[model samples]
Target: MHTGDLAVMRKDAYIEIVGRIKDVIIRGGENIYPREIEEFLYAHPKIAEVQVVGVPHERYREKVLAGVIPRDQADPLTLEELRAFCEGRLAHYEIPSRLRILASFPMTVSGRVRKIELREEPARER
Candidate 1:
């Protein structure tokens, strides 16, 4: 289905997706919604698609991470910009601490974005 179709489906459901079942980030005291950050990133004109995941965090138990696909080839949106956009739209704890840009998302044969696969990818070694 098209992006518009997916958007409509999500809207009709009245719930924002929070990554796959295993990817939720539980910070020191709150449950963060990664899809909230992803939706905020979609508001940017240059972004084509976005995904958010939870990765290990030394202080908070887990931190939010964003994976983005930009529409423009020359200048991808910066992590700072994505963070600022999300910060403006979401609770401070929901903002992503790490951001990655990809040319396209990995999808299933049926054209569904496979969030589980994204969540399984190894995080940056710190």
Candidate 2:
């Protein structure tokens, strides 16, 4: 299962794709998938969209960082708010250690958020 593509086999011998793998965060030797965290964040009323990324870390090799776009641009969500929302629902390692709540995400002509670029760019202060 390269990239952790989740699929379910049908009785008739077909497979269905449920979810595709997003970037993986390795913290203290554990591998955490971003999509799971992203899905959990989506349930929050304030979070309009979110993308989780792995940022460079000296001790753990990588840490979880979330690029979030709030439902209301004027009112932004904070790192604590998001962490509190994700508490208990998500594993400690799965929780975003860094939060970048932006008004809008950088996108491509195809309308897809550029995750690779996001991993490299510096985030604006809250």
Candidate 3:
């Protein structure tokens, strides 16, 4: 069924729903899954929480952006550091092109991250 859910069938015959079709980021003809990137970024010691979203880009149509909550407010994560950390770890296109340090992610009443709000945020705030 084409339910707009991105899933994978494991060798054990279990289906894993990774993300949604609408959430996929297409950059330079490459498909990037925010959930995959978010999972990888969760390993970063400096990152307490992270959300990956696609934003407008003239060249690629869309570009990867990361919203992160630093583990320590005193020592926030930097874009350079994030890129460096992603190097050799994630694909070139999968690396976040922009980084935003958010105090808290906009959430729904159900407690889900509001990605739509993130996409609508002003460039200055991002």
Candidate 4:
């Protein structure tokens, strides 16, 4: 697929989709896998779900922004809190510099989170 997908072929000739290739954030030339960061944060008690996206940055061209849904609505982690949590566990580049405490992710009828719509949120709000 030309839509930036990572896939694998099995011995039985089945094509299995892995992850979205375009979701990779190139920050200061470091490859930051959003899924890895998302999974890492899932282990934290405060985080219920997270979606990492790349936003424009003058220095790195792109930086990480995490859309977090808290386990407890009243206890959403601050950007600094999340940074502290990821400090030694994840590489510095993989840590999110910004956060959006979302009520819920925009989803398609097919049940997939619509990252395309998520990406356009800033523009839409203007």
lDDT per model vs. reference: 0.72, 0.81, 0.93, 0.83
Q: By the TM-score metric, which is better: model 3 or model 4? A: 3
TM-score of each: 0.72, 0.79, 0.92, 0.81
Position 109, candidate 1: lDDT: 98
Query: 1-126, model 4: which lDDT tens digit per residue?
Result: 397877779899998765688787889999777777888899988999888887778789778889899999987789989999999999888889888898899999999888776667743553
Leading candidate by TM-score: 3
Model 3 TM-score?
A: 0.92
What number of clashing residue pairs does each candidate have, in the order they appear? 0, 0, 0, 0
Tens digits of per-residue lDDT for model 3, 1-126: 579999999999999989899999999999999999999999999999999999988889889999999999999999999999999989999999999899999999999999998887844454
Q: Pick the candidate with the highest lDDT.
A: 3
Please provide, for model 1 over 7-112, each residue's C-alpha lDDT reduced to its tens digit, 9 standing for 90 to 100: 2136467754344434457987797666656777788887888888777777898777777888987899887887767665788888877777888878999997
Question: How much is the lDDT of residue 37 in candidate 3?
Answer: 97
Query: In what order do the candidates fall by lDDT, top score first?
Result: 3, 4, 2, 1
Candidate 3 residue-wise lDDT at 109:
100
Instruction: Give the poorly placed runs of model 1, Cα more than 4 Å off.
Output: 1-21, 122-124
Worst 10-residue lDDT window, candidate 1: 1-10
State the lDDT at 97 in candidate 3. 91
Determine the backbone clash count of candidate 2.
0
Query: Better model by lDDT, 2 or 3?
Result: 3
